[model samples]
Target: MRRNVIGSVEQMTGLQVVEVNIDVTDLQLPEDDEQHPLHDGTRRVR
Candidate 1:
């Protein structure tokens, strides 16, 4: 994935890529959309 991203960027912009940084912060499951309050017109309680 990193290689693909870097290659695509370099090809599109014609710029050399020195490095790539990736950070994964969150993932949403298929069921999450149904259970998440915001999706169903309810505010999330803080």
Candidate 2:
């Protein structure tokens, strides 16, 4: 994933990428999705 992302950025922008950083803040399970109701093209951040 990191390699692909870097390669895509370099290819599109013609800039050399030095590094990539990733931070995972939240994880949603299948059960969670089922429990929560879907919104109509709206998003909530907490």
Candidate 3:
């Protein structure tokens, strides 16, 4: 499901995704209503 979603975004945006970076360096926990900035959107980008 995730792969298809990304692929669709890439195609629509005409951007070649070089790599999907996994951010594990800054691991500060979230507070109330402060959900993930990247995930809480129609286009999930990193």
Candidate 1 lDDT (Cα, 0 to 1):
0.79
- lDDT per residue as tens, model 3, 1-46: 4577679879999997766654454443447225765545354235
Ten contiguous residues with the weakest lDDT in model 3: 24-33
lDDT of 3 at 37: 57
lDDT of 2 by residue, 1-46 (tens): 6888899999999999999996667666656765666733445686
Pairs clashing in candidate 3?
none
Model 2: lDDT of residue 40: 38
Error of 2 at 39 (Å): 12
Q: Rank the candidates by TM-score, best first.
A: 1, 2, 3
lDDT values, one for every candidate? 0.79, 0.77, 0.60
Q: How far is candidate 2 from the true structure (C-alpha RMSD, Å)?
A: 3.8
The residue-level lDDT of candidate 3 at 20 comes to: 63
Candidate 2: stretches off by over 4 Å? 25-46
| Model 1 misplaced regions, further than 4 Å | 26-46
